[model samples]
Target chain A: MKLKDILFVAITAVLFGIVYLGAVYMGAALTGILTPMGLGIYGYEPFYGIWFLAAVFTTYVLQKPGVGIIAEMLAALLEVLMGNFFGPIIFISGFIQGLGSEIGFAVFRYKKYSLQSTMLAATGCTVLSFIWTGIRSQYWTLSPMVVLGIFVIRLASALIICGFGCKLLADGLAKAGVLKGYALGLGQMTLEEE
Target chain B: MEKLNPFLKGVSILVCGLILSFSYSVLLNGGIIAVSLILLLFFSKARLTSLVKILVPAFVAAVSIFFTGMMFTSGSAIAPEAVSKVESLNFEVMSYSMTSVYNAIQLSSRILAFAGLGVLFAMTTDGEEFVKSLMHQCRLKPKYAYGVLAAFHLLPCIREEFAKAQMAFRVRGIPVTPFSMKPVFAMLVNTVHWSEHVAMAMESKGFDGEGARTYYTVTVIRWYDWCFLAVTVSLLVSGTFLLPF
Candidate 1:
C-alpha cells in the first residue's frame, strides 16, 4: 500500500470511531424502546451494519488491496481505546467482519465497485456474522423464525447501510474533490480501468 | 492502571476473553469475573462513580442477554414438549418459563465475562501505549504506526476543525446544523487535506517509506503480567473441571 493509502485508512478509522461510539448508545436505546413492544432484541438488527461499514466504505474509496481490513481493524482499535464495552474482542470481530467485506471486492478481483459487489460483500458479512453469533452466542437456541428474522433484517441492513448507503457517502465525498487523487474520484476510467 | 504495558494487558484480555467466550460454564464465567474484579480493586485507581458508569451497561447487557436468549429457546433442539416440563426444575412463580431460564445462562455468563474483561482493559490500558508497544515489539513500520497515532492525537483538534468549518459555513451563508450533511462533508474535505499534508511533511523530514525504526519507549512486560496470565489460565482450567454447568 502507498503512504496515502495508510493515511486514508487511519483517518477514516479516526472519524468513524466517533460514529461507532455514538452508534453503541443509539443501538442500546433502540433496543430498549423496541424490545418490549414484541420486537424483542432483533429490533436492534438494523444498526448492526454500521459496525461493519467502515471496511466497505474505506475499500470503496481506496480501491486497494488490504485497505478494507486495515480500515476496519483500525476503527475497532479506536473503539477499544475509547473504552468500548467489547474491549480487545472488537479487534477480533473487526478482523473477521472486514475480511468478510474484503471478500466481496476481492471476488470481483478488486476491480468492481458496482452496487451488486457491495451488496455481495455485505451479504457475506451477514453470513459471517451469523456464523460467529451462532457458535459463540448460541443462536441455535432461538426459534427458527426469530433466527430467520435476524438473518433477513441483518442482511437487508447490510445491503442498505453498507452497500448503497456507503456508496452514496463515498460518492458525495468524491464529488467534493476530497478524494481527487484516489481511485473513486479520478473518473471511473482513470485508475479504475485496471 | 497505567503502569501495565498496554500490549501485555491487551493480549491477556484477548486470550482470557476468548476462553470466556467459548466456555459454557456459568460458574467459570462468574469465577473469571470475580477474579477480574479483585484485580481491578487492587490495581485500578478508577473512581467508584466512573466504575459504576462502566458497569451499569454491563449489568443491563447481562440481563438483556439472558432474557433474549430465553426467547430464542423456542426453536432450539430442546423440543416444544420440554417447554412444559418445568416440573423437573421445580419451584414455579407466576407465568414462569423454564425454557427462558435454562437458555439464559450461557448468554448471561458470556456477557459477564465480556463486560468484566472490557471494564478492566478500558480502565488499565492506554491507546498510545498500545500503539507504541506494537512499534517497539512487533517492529511495525514507523510510517503507518505514527500515522495512526498522529490521527489519534488529532481527536481534540478535530473538534476545533469542526468549529472552524461551522463558522466557514455560516460565513458562506450556507445552511448547516449538527445533524446536517455540511459538517460531515467539511470534515471529509478537511481530514483528507491534512493527511496529504502530513504525509508530505513526513516525507520531506527524512521519513522512509517502510523500514526498521527505533523506539524511545520500549514496553517491558513485567513479572505481574506473567502472574496475571497464569492465574487467569489456571482459573479457567479449574473452572472447566469443577463446574457442573
Candidate 2:
C-alpha cells in the first residue's frame, strides 16, 4: 500500500463518516416526526441502506477490492467517534454491510459494474442487515406479520436507495468527468454502457 | 494539556455507552434520580460545546414524549364515572394508540441520552490521537486505521461541498430548507460523486487493500488506560446488578 493510497482511503473514509453522521441525524429526526404519523419505519430504512452508496462510491472510485470494507468501517468508526447511540453496534453493522457489498464485487472478480451487480450488492447488504436485526432481536418480540413488514420495507428501501441510487450517482459523476480511470470511467467505458 | 491515552479513551467511551444503554433499559423506570446517577460522570466531564450539541435532540425528544403522553392519558380518568359523564369517545383505542406512542417517546429519550453521551465523548477526544492509539494498543492494521484517519480529515471538505451544493441550489431559486427533498437529494448525489473521485485517486496510488504499511505517529497505553478499563468494567458490573430485569 503506497502512502498516497493510504492517504486517499483515509480522506474518503472521513468524508464517508461525516456523511453517515449527517444522514443518521436527519434520519433520526425524520423518524421522530414521522412515527406518530405512521411513517417512522421508512426513516431508518433509507438511512441504513444508504451505506451501500458509500460502498459503491468507494468501490467505484478506489477501484480496489477492500475499499468498500474500509469505507464502511471508517464510516462506522466515525459514527462511533461522534457518539452514535448504537456505539459498537455501528461498527459491527459497518463490518457486515461492507463485507456484503464487497462480496458482490468479489463475485464478479472485480471486473464488472453492471446494474445487476449493483442490485445484487443491495440485496446482499439487506440480507446481512436482516440477519443482524434478527440476532440483535430488534424484531424478536414483534409478530410474524410485523417482522415480515420490516423485512419488506428494508429490502425495498435498500433496492431503491442503494441499488438504483448508487447507479444514478455514479452516472452523474461519469458525466462530470470525475471518474475517468475507474470502472465508472468516462466516455464509452463507463458502467452505463453495460 | 493532560491527554488521556487514546486506547483508554476509546475503551472508556465504549464502556460508558454500554452502561448508559443498560441504565436506560432497567434503571430508567426508577425515574430521574437513577438516570442522573447513570449519567453523572458524563455530566461532570461535559463542556459547553457538548451541551449545545445535545440540546436539539433533547428538546425534540421532550416534546415528542409530552405529546405522546398527553394524547394517551388525556382520556383516562381516576374516577369511573368521569369517563362516561364527560363524553363518549373512542377511549380504549385512543389509550391503546397512545401506549405505543408513549413507548416510542420513551425510546426516543433513551436514544437522545445515548447520543448526548456520544457527543460528550466526541467533543472531548481528538481523532488523530484516537486512531494512533487504535494502531498501537489494539494492533489495528495500519492501512485500515490510516484510512479511517484520512476519512476523518476529509469530513470538513465534504461539509464544504455540501454547503456549496446548497448555495448553488439557492442561487437557482430553489429553496434549501430542512426536510426539503430536492436539496438533500442534490447533496447526496454530489457527495457520492466526490467520493468516487476520492476512491479513484486512492486506486491510482496503489491502494490494493493488501500488504505491509507504516505510520509516522505512535500510540502507547499507560497506567491511566488500565485504570480507565478497570473503572469501565466495574461500572458495567454495577449497572448489571442494578438492572431491573
Candidate 3:
C-alpha cells in the first residue's frame, strides 16, 4: 500500500470510531423508546450495532488485517471516554467483536472481498458477541424461548447490518473513487504510472 | 457566568451516575432505603427538568413492568382438583401470562436504572472536556482522542446531511420514515463518503503521524475528582452488602 493509502486507512479508522460512538448513544436513546414495546429485549438494537457495520465496511474497503479490531477498539475507547452507561462492559464487548471480525479476515488470508466472505465475517462476529452477551448478562438464567429470541435478533442484526451494510458501503465508496486504492488496487496504478 | 471546571463537571457526572445506579440496584433488590437514597440524590441535584425526563421513562417502565408481572403470574395456590377440572384449560394460559408479566417487570426495572443513569450523565457532562481528560489524564493517544472529539462536533453536521438527504428523497417521491431502513442506509453511505473526503483533506495538510503531541488545554485532577471516586467506590461496595431487593 502507498503512504497515502495507509494514512487514509488510519484516518478512516478514527472517523469510524467517532461515528460508532455516536451511533451507540443514538441507539441508547432509541432503546428507551423501544423498551416499553417489549422490543428492547434485543439489546443493542435500534442502533442495530452500526459500529459493527462500520468495522466491516472499513476492513472490507481497506482490505487490511487489523483494521476491524483497531476500528472497534478505537470506537469502544471513544464510547467509554464519552461516558457510555455500561462503562467497562463496552470496552470488553468491543474487544470481543473486533476479534471475531478479525478472525474472518484472517481465515480468508485478507485476500477476499466477496459478499459471502463479508457475511461470514459478520455472522462470526454475531456468534461471538452473542456468546459474550450470554456469559456477561443474566441471559443464561432466562428461559429457552427468551434465549432463542435474543440469538435470532442478534444474528439477524449482524447479517442485515454488518453483512449487507458493508457490501453497500463498499460499493458506494468504490463509486465515489475513495475506495479505488485498497479495494480496487488503484494505488498500484498510480505508482506504476509515476 | 457560572462555569464549572470541565474536570469537576465530569466528576459530578460520574458521581451522579454511581449514586443513581446504586440506588436503582438497591430498589430492584426491593430495598426501600435504597430507593429513598436515590430520591434524595435526585432532590439534591435540583435538576427539575432532568428529574422530569427521568421520571417519565422510569414511571412508564415501572407501570408496564407491574402489569406484565401481574399478567404472567400464577396466583399463590394451585386450584383444587374440582376447581382445576372446571378451569383446567384456562389455568395454564393464565399461569403463562402471569409469568411473562413478572419477567417483564424485572427486565423493565433493570433497563430503567441503566437508562436513567445514561440520561443523567449525558445531561450534565461537557463532551469536549470529557475527550480532553481522556487524552491527558487517561493517557489516550491524541490522534484517536481528537478524532472522537471531531466526530462529536460533527454530529450536527451529520444530522444536517441526513435532513438534506431526506428532503432530496421526498422530492424524488421516496418515503422518509425513520422506520424505513432504506433511507437510513442511503444516508449513512453518504455520510461516510463525506467523512472520507474530510479525512483526506486533513491528511493533505502536513498532518503527519508523529512525535509527542502537546495539548492546547490541560486537565488537572482535583480534590473533587478524588472525592467523587471514593464515594463511587464506597457506594458500589456498600451496594454489594446491602442487597436492595
Candidate 4:
C-alpha cells in the first residue's frame, strides 16, 4: 500500500479509536443503569456497530481488499495504547471483525462498493465476531433464546451503524472534497464528468 | 514487567487469554488475576489510582456478570454428559443451582482474568516503545508503525478540531450533545483533509516505506524476555491441566 493509503487508514483508525472509547464508556454507564432491570447485558448491543465502523468506513472509502482488516487492527492497537479496559482482547476482536468485513467485500469480488456490499460486510462482521463473543463471554451457557436475542440486536446494530453509516459518511466526505485522490472521491469525480 | 519486551509481553498476555478460552477453571483464572495484580502493583510503575480505577469497575462488572450468569444459565446448558456431572444444589432459585453458580464463576472469572491482563499490558508498556518493538522485533513495516505513531500525535489536534466543530454547530443553532454525530463527521472531514497534507509533506521529505533505514533506538529480545514468556506459558498451561475445577 502507498504511504498516503496507509496514512488515510491510520488517521481514520485513530479517529474512530476515540469514538470507540466513548462508546465503551457510554456502554458502561448504560450497563450500570440497566443492571437493576436485568437488561444490563444488552447495554452495549446498540453501540456494537460503532466498533465495526473503522473497518467498514475505511474499506468502503479505499475500495481495497485488505484495507478493512488493517484499519480495524490498527484501531484496536490504538485502543490498547489508549488504555482500554479490554486490552489485547480487543486486538483479537479487531482481527476477527476486520476479517469479517473483508469477507463481505470479497463476496462481490471486491468489485462492488454499493449499499448491499456494505450491509453484507456489516453482517459478516457481526456474525464472525459473534463466534468469538460466544466463546469468550460464555454465551453457550445462556439459554438459546437469550443468545438469539443478543445476536439479533447486534446484527441490527451492525447493519444500521456500520453498513448504512459508512456509506453516508463516505458520501458526505466525498462531497466535502476531503476524499479527493481516493477511490470513492475518484468515483465521484467520474460521475460529475459523466 | 515494564522492562520486558513489549512484543513478547503482548504475546504472553494473548496466550494467557487463549489458554483461558479453552477451560473454565476458576483456580486458573484466579491465579491469572492475582499474578497480574501483583505485577501491576509491585513490578510495574502503574499509579495506585489508575490501578484502583480499573479494579473497582472490573469488580463491579464481574459481580454483575456473575449474577446474570447465575440467573440465566440453564441446567442443560452444557452437553448432556457434562450436565449429568453437575450436582444440583438444594438451595436453588428458579433454575439456578450449583451448576449455574459454577457457570457464573467461570463467566465472571474470565472477565476478571481478561481485565487484569489487559490492564497489566496497558499500564506497563509505553506506546512508543510498543510501536518501536513491533517494527524492530515483529518486523512490522516501519511505514505502518510510523504511520500509527504520527496519527497518535494527531489525537490532540483531532480533539481540538472536534471541539471547534461542536462550537460551530452551537453557533448555527444546532443543539450539540456528546452523542451528536454532526460534529464528529465534521471533525473527521477536517482530519481527512489534514491527512492528505501530512502525506504530501512526508513525501516531499523523502519518506518511503520501501527503503531500508536505521533506527536510533532498537528493541532486541533479551534473555529475561524469553524467561518471562516461558514462565508465563508454563504456568498457564500447567495451571489449566493441574488445577482442579
After superposition, candidate 1 runs with Cα above 4 Å error: A37-40, A187-194, B75-96, B164-178
Give a tens-digit lDDT track for model 1, residues A1-194: 77767777787788777666666677677666755443456646887888778888888888887887888777877777677867888788888888898889889999888787788788877788778876767777666787788889999888888888788888888877777778888865465558
- Candidate 2 per-residue lDDT, tens place, B73-189, comes to 322322355344545478845544655455445544555544544454454556667777877888777666655655565667667877887888899998888556565556655
lDDT by residue for model 2 over A12-49, one digit each (tens)? 45555665667878877876876574445445665666
* Range of the 10 consecutive residues with the lowest summed lDDT in candidate 2 chain B: B70-79
TM-score of 1: 0.89
Worst 10 residues of 4 chain B by lDDT: B88-97
lDDT of 3 by residue, A155-183 (tens): 78788878887787667656655555465
| Better by lDDT, candidate 3 or 2 | 2
- Tell me the tens digit of each residue's lDDT in model 4 across B1-245: 88999999988888888888887788988899999999988887999997888777677678777877767786566446544455765433323466787888888898899899889898899999999998988889988888888888899999999999999999999999998889988898889988788889888988888889988999989999999989998999999899998
For this target, which candidate reaches the highest lDDT against the unseen true structure? 4
List model 3 lDDT by residue over B15-108, tens digit each.
Answer: 5444543343424433323443364355345366655644564455455444433433234322345345555668676655545554555545
Error of 2 at A75 (Å): 1.5
Output the better candidate (1/4) by lDDT.
Answer: 4
Worst 10 residues of 2 chain A by lDDT: A135-144
Give the per-residue Cα lDDT of candidate 4 at B113: 92
What's the lDDT for residue B169 in model 1?
87
* Model 4, span A62-167: residue lDDT tens: 9999998899888987887777777777888999999999999999999999999999999999999999988888787887777888899999999999999999
- The candidate that wins on TM-score is 4
Complex DockQ, candidate 2 = 0.23
